[model samples]
Target: MLNRLYFIFLLVPFLFLSCYDSNGDTEKSATLPIYQDTPYLQDYSVKYYFNSSVSPKKVFEDRNGVVQVLGKNGLYRTSAGQFLVDGTLIADNTYRPLKDKSLNGISLFQDQFVYVDDKAVLSNAWAGNLFLPHDLENANLLEPGSNFDFLISDGKELQFLSKDKAPWKGTVEDGNIIQIRYGHEANVFWILGKNSVSTFDASNNQIKTIKINNEATSFDVVGAKLYIGTQNGYFTVDSELNGKPSDLINKLPVPSITWIESIDEEIWFGSDEGAYRMDIDGDFNYYYGKRWLPGNKVVHISSGHEGRVHILTDNGLAQIHFDPMTLADKAAFYEKQVRDRHIRLGFNASLVDLKNGDVNSGRLDDSDNDGLWTSMYLASQVYRYKVTGNEEALKNCYESMEAMERLFTINDVPGFPSRSFERSGYIESLHDSDRWQHTDDPEWDWKSTTSSDEAIGHIFVYSVMAELLENDLRERAITLIDTLMGHIVKNDYYLVDFDGKPTTWGKWNPEYVNARPIMVGDRKINSSNIIAMLQTAYHFTQKEVYKEKAFDLMNNHGYFENLMRPMSEIGKAPEDADDWSKMLSEGWNHSDDEMYFLGYWGLYRYALNDTLKTKFKESIIDHWESERPEKDGAWNLLTAVCETQNFDLDEAAWYLREHPMDMRSWDVKNSHRKDLTFIEPNFRDQTTEEVLPPDERQVQRHNANMFRLDRTGGDGSEEYSAGDIWLLPYWLGRYLGVISEPRLNKE
Candidate 1:
């Protein structure tokens, strides 16, 4: 049964393909878009290192841009000192010669290194900790500005040390002492207490003190503002320290920040929660877990020569860098990723299946609708092979074709394709209503009661293979189409089964279609589908009966009028045509849009006559015009199959490239976002004021509403595969010459 079915499937395309003239008016000429090169967004390259022998304290760059890491045992330098690449590491500290055995802190001063142990020890070329300050206890080196100074404090007094100068002492008058702020060449010095900040000038004159409720731990001067990290969180105030401070801890991932490094408007914070980077816009991206960094407990963060940000954690050190790529580059990389990572195996064919992005492999018999999705992926490879001549693409296309064709012969009906087939005894019915039947071969079982969705998919893939396939494959595709169309016609345009009755949704006869009111989307879609099917059959077989039946439906049964009607008149059915059809169509059906467009390949491409072709183009344009606001990559790119001003080439590429790399189906909540623009609710709740980025929106099939912010799978949790969804539009765009291969970008 499978062998005969596969043979007819493989031979269907050769019989009728290339029937339309390449140079004829059927293929119209329009100015296609020219897309610019876009760089691919690269994934975060994170590498971890942990050695119990050494506890890293700080990772920073010296004045010369060379990366230096200071650990508990000693200090070390990287081989690529100028830029911290992923694996840039040198030997452990080989020279640990210091006057004092303990080295707690460090600062660079004009070709000299200052170390803080019991006192300040300055080390230079050919020397190690040669200069030590006397009477300095708990001393610390500070890199506030151009000058490398040392600061030491007791409970009553604070002293500052500069290059080749004695210590300058200052006294503070305030509530019980907390910490002192003395950095960033300013005229005023500040003393932080529990209740207020005490300010003193260069001559020890007390300035007006600012009162605060929270206790501060550290402070830094960034631009014209002063950021104070307190027990509650970080707060920002004017540089003068007398103005009100605004709390910014809510933006950070943590509650309390121990240290902060503010540079180039990018602030890095070491907080109780983790390591975080708060950008100029106040948005936060973090690195904490061992999956991202060496340790989750962040102690310090500092930036160096390159874009690398050095991190100091409780256990070890880590460095990270970012390099941006254009959108075009990302599209290619993602396309390849989908092919390599998501395709289902064991069939010896590249069939993309929904995955959880883990070790779980979704079997072919896992779902009844796998054939539909697999066909979409197969069609994409057909196009990819035609465009790039990739042999792997062609081989995958052939293998998937074999799998799709078996759906026909595996069933008892002449041309009815089952939703899915599995080896008997290995499968159980998912529900009571499931239509599983044992095949003639006792070893196999197949799903019955297939609907129009699977039928449209079969026709669509077979049609595409005819145009794109060559050699024996072309012939097989044509023969398969003839068989399926023949069966539909022979059974009175209904998918009859073992029970000898039409399946619930496989009806297209005048009796079933006309029974529905003119207002029903089913009426219009059925009219549209049958006409396209008849036209395809007539074109492939050169049969007069098929054309006559098409004309009878069009002229006598109002199928032509049903299809030619404007899409705007969809929801406004006349009062007289009020019934089940009208009730079912009170709201517009978006799935019909999918049905119309999928059938459109046959309707417009293999249209039997020029008159029908003109109406087909007009209908497609009207539908696209209404849907343009969605900014959907799938619909927009699919419409590009017809080259016109309506096609958005740039936006299409942007949508794909900007799609998030995280493909998991995590529950996303966008209702709390303060940045959304809202519009009044429309049909199916699709009328959102603003469209969220692709990643932030609900995970959905191409047929689902793109603007919806809250969406879960039918079963509440299913991270669907990106295989078919991405491949369809990508390969379609390539076939239409809308997007070209991107240039390889280098960092």
Candidate 2:
């Protein structure tokens, strides 16, 4: 019966439930010059899977725009679309356009197809064999020479074949061959063996081999220079093919290179762990894990048609496609993502139990902070609606607001909201089953143990809606505010659960708030949150008692002093403190960071007087100063609400732009990077001297440690919803007038 109720809620019509009013728009800025910089293109990837029966070794792009996957057994082709869409790997056929079943290698010579078999080298522009003296049975590397010739290697010797000329053979002095490439500028064929670099002077039939001190792994010849990769790092050789190689350059994200390819004048390196490209700015854009590839063991890197990158791995292929998109465009994409698969009973939820990051194979699972996540998603829609006056955005706000409303009504307790609810009879499968209880209706069960996190989230969204919406929606928002604050005040500042006891983390009374050490984060967070909740309630409801209680807590209970404590002073509790306070102050609580920012919305925005508003702004800026190292987009934008001039707007833009398009929780590792500066472990859990780009680290929400460098033990079974994580800051930036309109094609 409860499952039936869940279906009924899912089938409700959205169009008839809400409408936007044109008269209730909020006042905000038109543009901020500092944030008005031109936008750049964003990179998103589409993965292509291969058959388990095939072992893919290389990937290539043909002139006809088809992707060819060359395997150890045979070759295959996938006719991908022009734009970036997930591709389907075609199996069971080798692309034998030349009808040569015994073809050993292929290349492009003067825009024509060149095919080579064990007995012959052939091309479409030339009839019969160009050179057929040397055997090609064991060939691994193939390339076009500068003078219309072909250079092929079998990891032991190179076969230089030309029309009507005898094939010239060369081998390294002490090592097996690996790569053979012709440098156009040097007019010589560069050969790379296991531990040496050998150059072939075809004009004089002279072969020169330079033995490397380190164990050479890979090499790429760009123009006249040769870049060699060793076990430790990589370095470059001079254009003259000089005596000794330069010292190994180890300043890289990952230095153990496996393969290198210079495609379209850009160099790409593949390592045993991942792949990265060295941009013109001399910095690396690291692509690792399932977020960017099928597997971290990258076999080869090549350029696809029209600047796309085809990365071949042991598992399959990952094609990274770049496109120009503004933050608004990105928000629309995430908007669809939430509406399509992430919306579970109108609460933003993650898609879990996925198979190989396939969205169809996942289900919407429940979380302990359903209310908090939904409130963030709801606030994004609210800000989006106000920014564009979009009817769909307004409807989204209404639907999520209705879901929050049901959290209060799902249980019999007045003014108390459940953490989450689901159909009956699945208690054993649900998380925290001990906290699950049957509602008055036999068909449903609701979760208890709601914390202050959800409470502040509820108040934040409710206050935003009450101030920005009109008529029915406005009244509904204000009613929720009154209900929640009334319950807190009547019960002596606690969220009383159905069992009629204060839930853990929901204690904001003077006794509970003042009990912790002044250095503990909770002392400041709780005092700040309850005061903000009261201020929001008093502002919208025009209730004098809410105002009175707020002042009593601040003036008589030292709540103001607690809330105003500088963030620099927050650290481990004193040795004399109780165990609970010590535990609460262990390191820094990122959840407290999230909660503090959410509360700052009302604490600063709905201040009862200008003097309090000024004080609130100063406190917020102080906190933002402490948080500047993380470069968190949400925290920076939340502080932007205080209208401060220097809130790290540039860093916030970097956060939005540098965030990866893939939201899957893949195992990411950055502790191995040599380019990062490490700092001593401290109370804030900041391990690095500077934070890595969001794309290079583990994908997490606002409540996670931003400076965490690595995450292990993941199988890509979950795709986090960007609704709460990304859209909130993006839309909030739009509403705050920091990020401009789409700026389409501005880059």
Q: Indicate which candidate wins on TM-score.
A: 2
Q: What CA RMSD would you report for each candidate? A: 10.1, 5.7
How well is each residue in 248-269 modelled by candidate 1, as lDDT tens digits? 5543456577767776688877
lDDT of 1: 0.61
In angstroms, the error of model 1 at 195 is 10
Question: How do the predictions measure up, each by TM-score?
Answer: 0.68, 0.92
The Cα local distance difference test for each model comes to 0.61, 0.80
Q: After superposition, how far is residue 70 of candidate 1 from its true place, in Å?
A: 14
TM-score of 2: 0.92
The global Cα lDDT (0 to 1) of model 2 is: 0.80
Query: Which residue pairs come into collision in candidate 2?
Result: none
For each candidate, how many residue pairs have backbone atoms clashing (under 3 Å)? 21, 0
